[model samples]
Target chain A: MPGPDLLSSQGLRLDGRRPNELRRIRCKLGVFAQPDGSAYLEQGNTKVLAAVYGPHQASKSKSLQDGVVVNCQYSMATFSTGERKNHPRGDRKSQEMSMHLRQALTAAIKTELYPRSQIDIYVEVLQADGGAYCASVNAATLALIDAGIPLRAYACACSASMAWRNGQPEPLLDVGHVEEAAGGVVLTVASLPSTGSIGLIEMSHRLHMDYFDVVLSRAMQGCKDIEVILDRAVREHLAEGWTKQDVVVI
Target chain B: MFQVRKLANLTLFVTTTPTKRYNKINKSDCFENSILPVHFSVYFIFHRTKDYNSCKNMTRHVKIRLASERVNHSVSSNNELPRFYTPGEVITGMQDFMRGHGTYAEDDSLKASVAGVMQKVNKLICIRPLKSRYVGEIGDVVVGRVLEVQQRRWKVETNSRLDSVLQLSSVNLPGGELRRRSEEDELMMRKHLQEGDLISAEVQSVFSDGSLSLHTRSLKYGKLSQGILIKVFPSLIKRRKNHFHNLPCGISVIIGNNGYIWISPQEKSNLVEGDKDEIANVETQTVSRSERETMGRVKNCIAALVASKMMLDDTSIMFAYEESLKYEEVKDLLDTEAMLDVAFLTQHKINYVDED
Candidate 1:
């Protein structure tokens, strides 16, 4: 066991959040003027920007006939982490993140709507605070909404870690960088909360099978909470320019 | 000018809440008044929802809503602003309504697949987003830059989902309209329109893949020269019958439906018939200082209208132009405060004119 400081005697997490609490999520759609759809989402200390382009012609190599080709690229800024990384993308970690991002987003997008088309989603992490993947997924969801792409439901992702409190395994919601570096088992879940379907689940480090269900449910609950925030943001975006076309009632 | 003052009051009523943070007020009626203030919680919600003590700068993208003006000003309008729909929200439980773009039928109910306002045309319902890539329709005017020269076809980027195609057959040859497109014509394609050249064309057809086929068959619809191009959200541009207008202010504006606006000096006295050399030389002719100033003013005025989320038509733009005359300096309109002021005055003028 590490320092055991993840949860204090009062059951407060290291960041002063309650075990069941999540970080503050603030997001805005259509941040960039150039891309078809773009969004910036800040989850506590983690900041991510995502842009969606296309549902247009795909290059011959990447084209798909059965449904729209969903291409995703994940990259982090040079100053995003504490170390000042040498490369932004094409590395081993970013390539894996790119693949994982595509899997989660593809589950939400209605690909059949545009056969033989491709939607390119590019995510750039401006700040890294442990749950960067979760923030990136949330930001990409908002960007897809801004692009007017049809989706089954909002795909939300959240992270949880197993922490001991009062001799019981208490799963903390929205694990931050400090808690992650504390050598605890972190469970990340991306799902369509409305549909109760999991798109992707990733776990780093080992946890007993007896404590798995509680940790999973906590992360799932966090996903449900994130969906609500994203939904309200979308509605607010719609209301802002609801009258783009002057309805001609004949 | 008294009408202009009344117009200003109306706009002030609609848009005075941009700087008002949500923590200051908690009124329900304020939600319906405008869109951006409702976003006050977007910044305030973070502080209110969870208490995390860390220094971070929250940058809010300013959104100004002028749509409320149309709803509040029009008397015959019985429609409340269309109810917003988000992805997976059931549009109707009924199976009778046929789904259109931005929507789909799921589990025996009509559900919205996009985040936007729902538009119903009889039995077919579609969701039109506030902003998206340009969806080209036939007979629509567009300004696009050439992306690639591929054989007889020139791929043009029209701010659409895909690059639109401009075929050799669709354009009028320099010498004559009836001339056949020979091997030589294909070779000279880049000479006529190289990579990065801007042109104004009309949407001739929409392919099955959603790409548009553009044509420059008319003399007025060809290579654009010596003008400033301003791009806004395509939805800001109102679809009008005549997008090309030679404003009384001595500048011409092309309000492309694709959100590309080109402003240039009005063609000097309309070139005489069959003078291809003179028409070509018009590109080389220097634009005078006064004409350049007028174009700059028009460009800024259009930017002001776009920033406010107001419709961009010739009349609205002209009204904005007249309102901007007080600033004297064309570059002053680029400032956020000055842009909002001009947009407010323009809205007031539009609402005033509508009342008459």
Candidate 2:
């Protein structure tokens, strides 16, 4: 149900971005001193902070014999949205977001390495524009990396929406809040781009079966692009914090 | 073709902000697009204008900036940088190399599972992370706080994956090393080292589950009395033959391999050794004002070195302490500029010693 006005006459989206362009992403790793690993990420106007603790002793009930338990909690600030929200978390939507986060992150972490342990990832959304879930996944990935937890590959998430221009279906990459409210079919994909693996896929509103492939691929491409940016941030963090002792093991 | 265009735009956006208008539009778009309150948009605009004005004022006495404006503290070393690998990056073909820690073998190739520099010893290749929870080794000294007192054992948290175990049989009781642990001793465990009491111990063994078993068998290792415990990254602490140092400046420091540092007065140990029965009495002994000042200075010096992510050892600590003495007051060492100065001076001295 995306309106024709979703794209301008010049072939750019409402936010003056090309249909294939993602939102500007800025990130910093090890933002916190206490947590084992922490990161702050901003994708356009949406801001998220993620902290990873443990791979430590799991409590008696949560411990797994085969691998580590990935516990994730996603909470948005009361002021994250334009409206003043009463509850920060524990809502049904927050619970679902937390579960989706675990599904995406568990695929990236090499859990088998730390059996009988738990890795707790807590994501706090400071601002929510659009694609908050995708930003949470990306921030959590950076936190896990900052914690030095072994991972099979970086897990990146991105959301794409279908727009129409000149009687042709156009897949928009990195949907912002405005585009999301425009009644477009949004496809969110969490993937390990390097490994060509999809951890989780979700769709909101219905799209024609023929255009599904296009939207999905665009989202996957966004994830791949995000993986490259995250990889660069990790390398930059390592360079800054790398001491001589890190290189020459005593 | 779309992928190529996307990549090009991404690189362009990352390198330079030709898309500044897009960024501004994105911000304003959220306000206009959503049914959010008009006041919220006004507030955003007000904050933006205020920030812009602050940037224009050159001689402002008090400067306030957002968290996003915080400076990057990473200092690139002068030496040739080491080759670093990230997760899932293939290190080499797994024809002969044995994958070790932070690495996994998949698809006939050894891939790094963590971001760090690689270490190769013969056929064994391992990647060590820049920082992580302390992975204990046998004979490594550690300072841990008692978390739980369970059946004949005390659960001590040593900043590891699992809470380390300190069994009653492993520790030397108050009477002597040869004294048999009686049923009475089991009941008296809480009287000895209760919850939250700090203790210095050595890693006796490592369990198959990767948890450490610790022992306080030596006279040097036992319950820590009144002292300041400073926790740094375990990676910062260098592995040395001597972790306990009685500094020339009249304070003793126990640099636990787990990165828990105990800074206490020097004379306290001598007092305990002289009258063994009065071990509990030592806690009541008030530290002199001068001794407390020296301990504070030493603590600040260590903080400086840790701030710079320098390798911590007795020599490095002492060099920092000596360099910090020029700054008269101990509290002054806490300043960011002073900390950087002390760290820089200590690094110079350490490099000088290495060259010799």
Candidate 3:
């Protein structure tokens, strides 16, 4: 009974959020002028920056005849986490995260159209608040959109956690660092929300089969909510730069 | 043939209706500001822990603004903003229209796959994003840097997604026109254009995979020396019959379609017909202090226009130059206030011309 309390007696989560409440997502596209596309995204206390370059001619070693190659790199700054880290990138954990990011983003990108081309996506986590991977994925999606790359739909990612209240199991949306360190089961999901299909699913702790559906559904729903926010940002960005003369009528 | 909407004309001509326009502006401002949440202090769950510094770091200096606050404010377009589509938004049914770039067909609907304004030409629909990598078209004048000197070609980076090719066959061989390229000429490729050297060329052809083939066969197109290069988004450059201009203010500007612009002191009439040797000698010739000042002013003026998202062409550029004369020194044009003033005055001049 001495464990950290994930939920209070009144049913609000530890962070005073409801079971279905998400972290506040604030994002901006075209944050950098040098990259083909760049975006900065902040989710709660976590902040991420993503940049995308190319769809250009690929090198001989990496070129593919049938589809485009997606290259991803995930690096966390030394100051991003509670402990200072030595390496910013090319570590074992960063390598795995890079592969995972490529897998999720490639599913949403229309890669077949750009044969013999490569798209490089680099994500830098400037701050970590437990859902850094999810924030990185979301930031990469925005950067790709800013680059004007063709995509099947908006790719979104979210993390969910499970807790018990009065012996009834409930799922929490958008888990932060505090709950993540409490030895709770954290389920992360990346999906194309518009298409209603999940691209990647990762779970940190084992959970009972009976409660799996609840947690997965919560994560998917978080993705859908994130899709709405990201879509609004893209539309607003377009409206800001759009002019009446760009469209031709014939 | 897209017709400019009458509302755009009205916005320019109907300046007399200040009350209604003022109300509309205020209403739009309210709508934009209301969408974003008010800024609050950062939330830290582990306040009782040993590290209070981390909590302070979370709230550190984040400049959050609503999307509307990032708009280009140096100049406002008279044209009404267009309807925008995001990825997966169904633009139209797939039955009648052919899908183009930045669009895809899914579930019997033609959806936009990029965020931009939609354009319909005949039976084809395309989305033109506001900013993207340079997509080359034939006959486009582009400024590029030599990236690598390969067998019979020099790979040039023209701000396009791909490295463009400048073949030896396509170049003027630095001596004369109608000269056949030889093995000796191939060996001398690097001597003519080495790595990191800038050159202005014409886009001769586009490859099937979207790479451009550039040619520097004309007298106007060749190795550029002693000029400041400025790059802007390709979409901001307006396509016109002439991309090169010799401004009356004693500076020459080459507005490349790839968004790499070159500004240099205008060559005197005597220097125009210089050969390779004479051209090399001209490089050593000292450019007068006045000419250098004029060149810097032209470069800064173009930067001001680019910052405002104004259409970049010779006329608008010249207008910006004329408006920038109020600034006594060339370096002063780069300041925020002067940059905005020059852009605003140039936009006014452009609108005045449109009215006439």
lDDT, model 1, position A131: 97
Q: What TM-score goes with each of the models?
A: 0.84, 0.88, 0.86
By DockQ rank, best first, the candidates go: 3, 2, 1
Compose the digit string of candidate 3's lDDT tens values, residues A152-240. Answer: 89999999989988878889999999999998989999999988898899999889999999999999999999999999999887766
Docking class of 3: acceptable
Candidate 2 residue lDDT tens string, B1-356: 00111121111211122323223434344555453433311122112333445433432222233345454434334567688899999999999888899999888999999999998888889999888889999999999999999999999999999899999999888776798899999999999899999999999999998999999999899899988999998999999998999999988999999999999988544555647557666787889999999999999999888888888999999999999999999988877678888888888888788789
The DockQ figures for the candidates are: 0.30, 0.40, 0.42
Question: Which candidate achieves the best DockQ against the true structure?
Answer: 3
Candidate 3 structure quality by residue, lDDT tens digits, B1-356 = 11111221111212222223223333344355353222432211123235546544543332233344343544676887777888889998789899988999989999988888888889989988888889999999999999999999999999887789999899987566877888999888889999999999999999998889999889899998887899988888888899999989888999999999999888768865655677778667788889888888888999888777688999989999999989999988866668888988998898999999
Evaluate fnat for each of the predicted models and list the values in order: 0.59, 0.66, 0.69
In order of TM-score, best first, we have 2, 3, 1
lDDT of 1 at B269: 78
Error of 2 at A106 (Å): 0.6
Over 4 Å off, model 2: A246-250, B1-77, B268-274
* Range of the 10 consecutive residues with the lowest summed lDDT in candidate 2 chain A: A241-250
Q: Which ten residues in a row have the lowest lDDT in candidate 3 chain B?
A: B1-10
